[model samples]
Target: MSADTSSRSSRQDAFDPFLQPELFEGVRSRRIIAFIIDAFVITLLTLGASILVFILGVFTLGLGFLLYAILPVSVALIYAAFTLGGPSASTIGMRAMGLEMRLWYGAKPYPLLAAVHLLLFWFSISLLTPFVLLVSLFSDRKRLLHDLILGTVVINSAYHRAYTREHSAAA
Candidate 1:
C-alpha cells in the first residue's frame, strides 16, 4: 500500500512545534509582559551607563558630555542584538519573565536579522515619538515597528504548550 502522506505530514508538523500556526495565538499579552521585563533591564543598563559616563566626564574635565549622546543607544542596541542572537532569543529579563522571541511567520531569527530587528525598534521608538507603537495596535501580527520589519514575535514562554514538550523532553 502507498504511504499515507497526510498522516505523515501531520506527524512531522506535530514533531515541530515552532511550525504550528496556533502556537502563536494570544501573543499580545505575552509581548506586553516581556516588554515590562525588558524595560526594567534597559533601565538598569541605562542607569549604570549614565553613572559611568558621569565618572568619565569628571575625569576628562567635561568631554563625557559628548559620550552621553550615544551611550544609551549604543548600550541598548548591543545588548538587544546579542540577546536576540543568543539561544534564548531574549534578554535575561525576558527569560526571567518566561518569554521568548521568535519570527512572526517562522522560527527564531538569526542573530544578524535579530540585531537589525533591534535597531529598527530603537530607531522607530526614538524618532517617531508616538506613531511607532501604533503599528502594534493595527498590525495583524500585533507587531511593533521593529517586529514588523524583522518579522519577529515575542510570546509567553510560561503558557506556551511547546515549552511543556521541550521541558518534558529535557527531563
Candidate 2:
C-alpha cells in the first residue's frame, strides 16, 4: 500500500494529456519563453567564461588561449548538467519561467541525461533548424526531438507536481 508501490503499479499511468490537460496547458508557449531565458543565461555565462579564459591565456602566455575554442560549449554543458539535474530539475531560466523537466517514466533527470539532452538539442538544431521546433506543434505532450529521444517532458511547475509530491510523501 506504500506510495512507491502504488506508483510503480501504475508505470503505465503516464501523465496523460487526455486525462490531465492542465499539464500541457500553455506548455508550448512557456517552453519558448524558457528557451529564450535559458539562452540569455547561457550567453551571460559564456561571456564570463570567455573572460576567465582570456585571463588564463594571459597567465599561461597564450597556451590557455586554446581553451577559448571550447569555453562556451563547456560552460553550457556544465550549467545544463548541474542545474537540470538538480533537485528542481530545471535551469535558472526554466525556474524563472515556472517550468521543470521530468523523465517520461516519472523519475527525475540525472546529470548525464541532462547533458546528453543538451548535446542532442545542439545537434538537432544544427541539422534541422526550423523543423526541430516544429515537432512540438504536432506532439500531444509538446516534446521536441531531443525530448522524444530522451523520453522527457517539460511541465508547468505551478501545477500538478504538488500532487506528485503528496503522492511521494506517503512513502
Candidate 3:
C-alpha cells in the first residue's frame, strides 16, 4: 500500500479494541453507572407521564387508562430517541457518566439508529439478560450484545475530548 493508504489504515485500526484496548478503557464500569443513571431518569420521566395520563383519563372518562399503561414505555422511547440521536450520541445519563456511543467506524449514530439501538437493547435485556451481559465480558471492546448487533460501541467521552484537543494542537 502507498504511504497515504497505510496512514489512513493505521488511524482506522486505532479504534479496533483488539489492536488498541485503550480506546475502551474503563468503559465497562462507566457503562454500568450510566445504565443506572439512565434507568433512574427514565423512571422519573415515566412517573410524570403516568400522572399526566391519569389526569387526562379523569377527563376522558377513564379512557386514559390505556395510555397510562404504556406511558413508561413511551416516555423511555422518546427520551432515548431525542438524547441518543443528538450530535453527542449519548443520553443524559451517558453524558453525566462521561460516555458516548459511536458507530464502529467512529461516526455518530443518527436518530433512527439510536431508536433501534434502544429497542434492541430492551429486547436483548428482556430475553437474554445473562447472555447479553456475559457477551461483553468476553469481548475486547466491552460491548454488550445489543451494541455488537448494532455495530456500535460506548466510549469514554473524556478520553475523546483529550484526544481531540491533543490532535488539534498537533495539527
Candidate 4:
C-alpha cells in the first residue's frame, strides 16, 4: 500500500506484518547479510578516504592526518545518507540483497531521516551491543530498535512494486 498522502491517518493503519507477510519474508536474515555487505563497502570507502587523507597530510605536513580519527564514522554516515536516502531508499548492499526501507505508511525516507536512522542504529548498538538486534526477533515486522524509533520498516524489494498503483488498479 502507498502512503495515505490523501489524508491523515494513524500509524496503526500503516503496513501490517500480518497482512503483508511477503514483504518481511527472510528480512531478519537478509538484514544481517546486508549489514555485512554494507560494512565491507564502508571499509573500502574508509580506505580510499585514508589514501586521500595521506596525500593531504603530505601537503600539509600531517595536519590532515587528524581526519583519520573520524574518517570511518564520517564515511558511514555520508554513505548511508546518499544511498539509503536516495530514490531507491536502500543502500548498495541493501539493494544487492533485494531489500528497501520505507516509512510506516510506505513513503520513502529522506536523506536526513536515513542518516538519523544510521545514527540511531549506532547508538543502539553502542548502548546494548549487537544484542540490540534481538529486538527484531520479537517484532511483528521484524523491525530493529532503530527502525521502530524511526517509524521505518525494511521489506523485500522484489515485492516493492507488487502493490503499486497499476497492480492495485488491476486488482
Candidate 5:
C-alpha cells in the first residue's frame, strides 16, 4: 500500500506503523552501527572474490581483471535485490545492523519491486550527490528519495520480529 496521504483521516491514523512508535525507534544510531558492521563483511567477501578472479586471470586466462571489475558490482546488486525482496526484507548489512526492509503494507516486497529499489539505491549512491544524503534530513522518517520512491521502509529487524510475535500472540 502507498503512504496514506489522505486528509480525511487523522494524521496519526494515516500511517499504520505510527500506531506503534516503538517500531520506528529501532531505526536509530544502533542500526547505523549494525549497518557498518555488515558493510565491512560484505566488502571483505567482495575483495576475496575479486582476488580469486584475479588469480584465475593470471593462470593464462584474462578473466581476472574482468571479474575484478564486475564481481563487486554484481555482488552488491544481488545483495541489494535479494535481501530487500527476501524474507528478511533488508540487505545483509541492514540485517546485521538489526534493520529489516518492509513494504508500505508492513510486509515483504515482490521480487520486481526489490530489484527496482536496489537499482535506485546504487544509482543514487553512485551520483554521490549531497542532496541524496541530505534527503534524510528533510524526511520525517529520515528515508532517502530512493526509499520513498519504492514505498519501502527500513526498520530494526530485531524490533520488527519481536513486534510481530507480540502482536500475533495478542491476536
Candidate 6:
C-alpha cells in the first residue's frame, strides 16, 4: 500500500475494539442482564398475544385458533426487531441495562441494521448457545460471534450519551 493508505489503515486498526478495551467496559455483564430483561418482555408480549388470539378464536368459531401456531414467535420477533431497530438502537431490556448497540465505528445503527443484528444474534445463540457466550470471553469488545460478524458492538449507554452530548455541543 501507498504511504497514505498505510496511515489510514493503521488509524483504523487503532480504533479496533480488540485494541481499545475501554469501549467495552461492563458490556459482558450488562448484556446478560439485558437478555434476561428482554426475554421477560417478549414473554409478556407473547402471553398477551396468546390471550388475544384465544378470544378472537372463540368469537370466530375456532378459526382463529390456527394463529396459536404462530402468534408467540411472531410477536417476539416483531417486538425484538422493532425495539432493537428503533432510533434508540436498544431493546427495552438493553435500555434498562443502560446499554445500546452501535456500529464498530461508533455510529448508531439504522432500524434495518438493528433488526438484522438481533436476527443474527438469535440465529447464533440457537445454533451455539454456550459456545456463543464463550466467544465473548475471548473478544476484547466482549462481542459474541454475531456482533463480530455484523461489525457491531454493545457499549455502555453512558458512554454513548456523553459522546452524543459532546458532539451536539460541538455542533
- The TM-score values for the models, in the order shown, are 0.65, 0.89, 0.87, 0.90, 0.74, 0.82
In the predicted model 1, the residue pairs found to clash are 104-151
Sorted on TM-score, best first, the list reads 4, 2, 3, 6, 5, 1
Sort order, lDDT high to low: 4, 2, 3, 6, 1, 5
Worst 10 residues of 3 by lDDT: 13-22
Candidate 5 per-residue lDDT, tens place, 1-171, comes to 345655334443323555666666746465468657757866987988877887898984785577666787777666666666777677666766677777665667766787787678768978966777688666666577788888777666676678768879999
lDDT string for model 2 (1-171, tens) is: 999899876874566778777878888887788889888998999999889889999999999999988888999999999999988999998888888898886677999999999999999999999998899989998999999999998887777677678768998
Q: Per-residue alpha-carbon lDDT of model 4 for 1-171, expressed as tens digits?
A: 457744556556556778778889999898889999999999999999999999998999989999999999999999999999999999988999999999998889999999999999989999987668888989999999989889999999888676665568988
Give per-candidate clash totals: 1, 0, 0, 0, 2, 0
lDDT of each: 0.70, 0.88, 0.86, 0.90, 0.69, 0.81
Sliding window of 10 residues with minimal summed lDDT for model 6: 11-20
- lDDT per residue (tens digit) for residues 1-171 in model 3: 999999777756546776556668888888889889999999999888888888999999998788966787788888888899898899998999889998877788888898899899999999998999999889888999999898888888888778868988999
> Which of the numbered candidates is closest to the native, going by highest TM-score?
4
Which pairs clash (backbone N, Cα, C closer than 3 Å) in model 4?
A: none
Better of 2 and 5 by TM-score: 2
Tell me the RMSD of model 3 versus the true structure: 2.7
Tens-digit per-residue lDDT, 1-171, candidate 1: 347877565544432334543445666666667768877887889889999999999999999869888887778777777887777787776777666787654366677876688777768878995787677678655667777666677766655546667878999
Looking at model 6, residue 112 earns an lDDT score of: 73
Q: Where does candidate 6 stray beyond 4 Å?
A: 1-20, 167-171
